[model samples]
Target: MQVASNFKVLFIAGFGPIVREPSESRELYCEVLGIPFKEESGGYLHTEALQGAKTFALWPLSQAAHSCFDSDSWPEDIPVPQAWLEFDGDSVEKATANLESRGYRILVRNKQEPWGQTVTRFLSPEGILVGVTFTPSMRKEK
Candidate 1:
């Protein structure tokens, strides 16, 4: 088989949040963390944080809830992708604890991966899966 020569991750595109409670997610994400994000309930919220990169979008609360839990009624708007955005950090455990201490739900706790990465995951206000990870030094050899 011929090898494909192109290898790049320009966007490395990760899914953004589509919250159940736009206000709360926005408040926690923007107000609490001081991360700049816009609010758009009708269609979805788009952010300017990652320019020239992929953008994040939000959906209405009702629509998102229905989409995830299997509601009979589906929104006319396009469905948000079912994926998680992986954010690499120096301290995954520290970050996970901080979010948990603040009362945010934690879907997964800090767990060590065989590949040498510590990871944690959770649902955003909109029900989208979000994650934080750290590459453990042991995996540096690979």
Candidate 2:
């Protein structure tokens, strides 16, 4: 089925590998590759200031689980995602609603994160965790 024309995806906000090992992953992405990710609580490492088509990150699986299901573990029935992708829309709320109306299963709805982002999350058909987010801190200064 075709999605509605109004539900245009403005751009990809973030994309990266979801890792089980934070220290090793941090060594690769932050130390070795020098991606300049700031260390956050619970092994999550990310940077919103990266210059590219998408902000990159090395997110922990446990963190992903917490964000999607409010638990420390991914549900046994659901496939564990290998990666994640977040989209920035003109209006995150509208985008989320649009996706839901189209029969997408929203795992998290308009959840405000501690780092200051409002996000709605779901799993893609391929099991990648997807987020529709409005993160003011990530906005480039005009």
Candidate 3:
């Protein structure tokens, strides 16, 4: 008999809808970001596009932690996560410049990662951490 194996983690999901200094308004995910997310009848967003194998959703951080019980909870005083998105691109520098010009704050400049790939980071208006990277040299090895 063959047993089925569970799908391993494919991506990271950062829950949102948080109550913070600058609330991540629903429009950012629904319209501005153009994520095309699904929502419930009550108008709660179901999920956002991580654009990968891992599924990311939006929920109150406290409530989300409770749903995923048996783990350490988020500290009430600590800053909640800023969402992250990593991408494989041809020119990270160019992308970074374009994004920066568009008003996205550069969290980190385009630098070569220890893994030997070019990467850059930026923050969304809501303080979400987003990134873009390319591993062309590494991909060639494969």
Candidate 4:
């Protein structure tokens, strides 16, 4: 059976683990792995220095919950995600529609973040929080 996709994925915008223990995660990525990450407000740590992914970060669980549900606590009804993966797509709306048509429950649809990325989020079968997004900053010519 062939499944149709309405949107094209341009690239992997970002990938990261959803960190429950910020100190442990920070020590691993920053101290042990030696990945240089800049800490932002609310304990968000990110870097564009990694070669494979456009953006890699230690996304705190609180932030992830806030992004998806506008709250600091993860909803008990949904499984807690272990990691996050974002694919930059040609059209977020088209991808969102395609996902819905295929029976995937979308957590958030085409929500524009404060950082200007337009994203649609859903949980994958493996419990990874996946996002189809259009990120202007990542698309810029380097």
Candidate 5:
């Protein structure tokens, strides 16, 4: 059997530090560290203002569940993730198709997120939420 080529992960698209206690978590990352975060009432802490090569976010578990499974609760079969990582890919569709062909269960595919990213998401063996994505806004000006 011919093996498929490895998916080309361009770079880190985003990093979400999963939080269970939003209020306390916000106090730390936002108040203590002085990370300018636009707090959401729904518990998603985010900012495009952070100066870095990689974007950072404070993601609530409930929000993650809604994004992945379209529900407020995580499926009992899949382990709850402590954090989420999105990897930039050349073609999210092709990468997603390859994963499916290799028997990986895709939770979401080619979903255009509200922030304008085309993503394919799944759970890693270690239970971390992972995504293969193409986010145009994250691209740097040449």
Candidate 6:
């Protein structure tokens, strides 16, 4: 049975591994796979060339930590996520509420990033860092 909710995911905004080793990740995604990733500050490597996802990147663990907790280290109480996935939705607030009502503990709630994306984050059963987001730039691409 499918339970309906106010939250609606429009598309997958992004997906990538939360890399502990930047060099190894880069070597595999860029060198071995020839992903043509562009390096950014904080050792972030990303590319929009991949067809299935709007963005694909090797997101450094420290960067993910900083994004979620405003610190360079992940909280010890939380399980370290191996990768991250984002779902672009109609309303982040609604999605957040839905998740909370379903008993999911949210990590971050409707936080806007410096790069102009509003997101609510949490961890999935498989340990993937998931984000319900409203990304204006990505929506504009549609």
Top model by lDDT, which number? 4
TM-score for all models, in order of appearance: 0.52, 0.61, 0.45, 0.63, 0.61, 0.63
lDDT of 5 by residue, 1-142 (tens): 4546876656556565666666655654564335687767887878887544466578889889999889999899888987777778678988787767756678998899999999888765545687888999988789
lDDT score, candidate 6, position 72:
99
Question: Residues 1-142, candidate 3, lDDT per residue (tens digit)?
Answer: 3546775654445555443433354544444344566768855566655444232555464642332232357545434455544556577887777776656655567777666867676555565545567766545454
* Tens digit of per-residue lDDT, candidate 2, span 7-80: 86667666677665666555544543345777778867778876555566789999899888889999998878
TM-score of predicted model 4? Answer: 0.63
Off by over 4 Å in 5: 1-53
lDDT of model number 6: 0.79
lDDT of 1: 0.60
Deviation (Å) of 61 in candidate 2: 0.8
lDDT of 4 by residue, 1-142 (tens): 3546867666777667766678756764565335689889999999987656676678999999999999999999999988887878678998888778767789999999989999999886557888888999888687
Ranking by lDDT: 4, 6, 5, 2, 1, 3
TM-score computed on alpha carbons, candidate 5: 0.61
Candidates 5 and 6, the one with greater lDDT: 6
List, residue by residue over 11-129, the lDDT tens digit for candidate 1.
Answer: 63444565677688766666544566566778465676743323344545454334334464434563443654556666888878778887877656787766776777666666555
**Colliding pairs, model 4:** none
The candidate 3 region of ten consecutive residues with least summed lDDT is: 63-72
RMSD of each: 9.6, 16.8, 9.9, 16.3, 16.7, 16.2
List candidate 4 stretches off by more than 4 Å. Answer: 1-51
